[model samples]
Target: MPVLVNSHPSPPLHIDMTPPKPIIAVVTGTGAQGRAVSRAFHDTGKWHVRVLTRNPAGKVAQAFQKEGMEIVKANFEDKASLVKAFEGAYAVYSNTVPPWHQSYTNKLGEYEQGVLQADAAKQCNVQLILFGTLPYVGPEFMGLGGVELYDAKARTNDYITSLGLPAVYISMPAFIDNVHSWPLVKAIDGGAKLEFVGYVVKPDKPMVFLWVERDLGPSVLAIAESFRTFGRPLAEHPLNHNVLPVGSWRGTWGQVSDEIEKQTGIPTIHNVLPSVDQRWHRELTKVFHYQNTHGLFPTDNFPTKVFSSLGVQYGTVEEFVRTKIAPMFRKS
Candidate 1:
């Protein structure tokens, strides 16, 4: 009974107050990759997402803003804007669109943007950086050339490592989402009977494919969280400077087409390309040849364990076609 007199329970101590979530700066946040990353982290309710985009007034930016994300205006070519956007960001996801598609720039421009983003991240003292990149499948591999896209990104990867910044290289594979863009899908949409186009590679040759919005975003979110939780102090983390080859499923193109037919209930036929003379066709042929000769990953490793630890389960190719691809035909 010594001090048993009413002490108001210490005012119920506010020790349970939630800590503020880390702020992650997503470069090109309105794009496919950036949007996926932002949505994944935002869904977790454990991160404050700040997206960097040149067009904050665009539809995608407005949509994101309505979802409670912070959008900042920045351009890849403008290092100062990037620095300002990156200021106080706990981490950054860096990506550059292949300039070949942008109509004004070339591969060199893409590489420059990557370097500028890395430099800006460095200046802003971002704790971690994840690069969306591909393997440097160049002539050095087997006298196979024409893959300037991959080579430019590989050079950027090298530059990022040279900066001595904490980084993770996430090598994205061919996207399953591209199936919609393929002539096969267009033919189906136009009421033509389905016909599968086979490439120069063998039917049994394995290809890696990812459902970008489904697989990529979650994988990136896991990597970012893992770096924060386990990758601090650099040397203690296994992922530091690690190259993670990511994809949803690995299958021969034939197998993928078969799955598509099965899921879509469309009869299909497979035929090799009539010609490979066009620059685009020639470049793609080189890619298929390289993949057939060498493998997509550096080692046979697939990072399954890492993805598992992060609780990410990739959807099967059939599942993707059923849920994502088949619907397009119905819409048309």
Candidate 2:
């Protein structure tokens, strides 16, 4: 009686019992980069995500747990713990941070920790390792001595490569998130109206601002896939084996100010700091100077084809200011 004319007998069910997806261990999984990289790998549902944190009971760790990530407690200073956590992983996303509690940036400690991470990855025999390192700003460059915050990670980049491990160094552009800082944005006390938006860079120096939370993850996915498939981007690449500098929107802080003002109808300015007296201010100004003096990130070979071929869409500085930063009128 049923209308079964179009349907013959159903085929038998088949469940292929293949091995599970590869595991990617995210060391320092609670930081911003950690959250981005881990989420990128996790969202693909193609990899078994293992996030290493010092506190498994912490809120961030718990959130990772809810997302089906394997949370393994790890302390970078403790090499044995890292080794145990890193074992049996296909790849490792190594992001080492200096303990801000100790003078903002600990150069020696970060370098040592990076070596430890590299050592662990080597011991585990991982297929790939990704290090979130900054461009090496050594004392020889501009004689600003060297920004330890950047140099520490740069030192680690060299350390990772020295081991001959399969690795990709990821140099992130300046974070657009700095728009939220007190010096950058101003608003009528507790009100929604913007007063002023500002930054420290010289008005016209073109810098790359990345919406890391949204873009970094996918870029990581793209890079990892390329490395996994053909050991590098199938598309011709210009960068050396050590660093793959990913680029996004290209503009200056002055242009950024104009964009914010255009979106919010507020006055904006490049309020360059009068003096780099404060310790943090001095260090940060050096970073801006580094970008100003010797250019920041180059975009010519950003794996655009790989990104498009893989159906990846990236965010722009304008969109970021309009959607996330603009909501913040939300910024001053």
Candidate 3:
């Protein structure tokens, strides 16, 4: 005989909860690129943002922490710290500062740090590793013999791929904000008219440019979303999976200068030097030569389909100057 208790069903249970967001660990989050990535993920509200920085008390780190994101103190030189910081992260964005900027004469330091970060990500079992990389212009390339910066990034790119961890390489070209740092801008600040200098490349030679602060975050977010939607199998996708060279626009120095004049109402003059003889010029000349000859990433093409599918819009140089650059100059 079965004993049946008249147990009336209690009130229907009501529980509402959303799934947890994916965790993204951003290395060197105190810097420009890393900070942009952190903000991007934060804005989406789709991922939990954890930033790894050597200086957790730094201004930028504090700002990020105040935004309710996790801040983990980790040094690039310390692999253990990186591994610990990377633990439980679904994806990791690793970017290393140039050695010269850190007062180190050795260029190989960038490559070493990149490898260390990649190894940590692998150990932590990160599903995706996005490396900030650049094209390698080696000695084998006709005009790029002395460009150590490009070569170092190229080596790091190779090392990241060698790890066989699901990875995406984001290659940033020259930043449009660099115009503000140029001597020409300094001269403008000193009440001189805008006078620009172009090295080996012709005035009409097109150069790829990016507005890092605005574009980087959106670009990274789009990439992450693409990875999630397509899954790990897309890592082996021939076109969309591998390297993404990101730039807002492409224009010649002449066109850039013209835009500056049009936006600021200040006439601009540009000088194209026939050859570079100064040490700085000589070093950079090789880079320009390589860019002109081999071209930066085959006709300055970007992953259009990926960006379009993600509905991410990249800004134009004119728009950047008018909206972002002009305001600063106006204030000054």
Query: Which residue runs does candidate 3 get wrong by more than 4 Å?
Result: 1-17, 102-108, 143-146, 181-184, 187-192, 197-201, 231-241, 271-286, 300-303, 330-332
Residue-wise lDDT of candidate 1 within 128-188, one digit each (tens)? 8889988887666667654766777778888998998888888887677766654445444
With candidate 1 superimposed using the best TM-score fit, by how many Å does residue 314's alpha carbon deviate from the native?
0.9
Q: Compared to the true structure, candidate 1 yields what TM-score?
A: 0.84
Task: Give the lDDT of residue 30 in candidate 1.
Answer: 89
lDDT score, candidate 3, position 2: 100
Off by over 4 Å in 1: 1-18, 102-108, 181-184, 188-192, 197-202, 274-285, 298-303, 330-332
- Write model 3 residue lDDT over 201-233, tens digit each, in one string: 676876777777788889988888877777447
- Clashing residue pairs in all predictions, respectively, total 0, 2, 0
lDDT of every model, 2 decimals: 0.77, 0.74, 0.75
Window of ten residues with lowest summed lDDT in model 1: 99-108
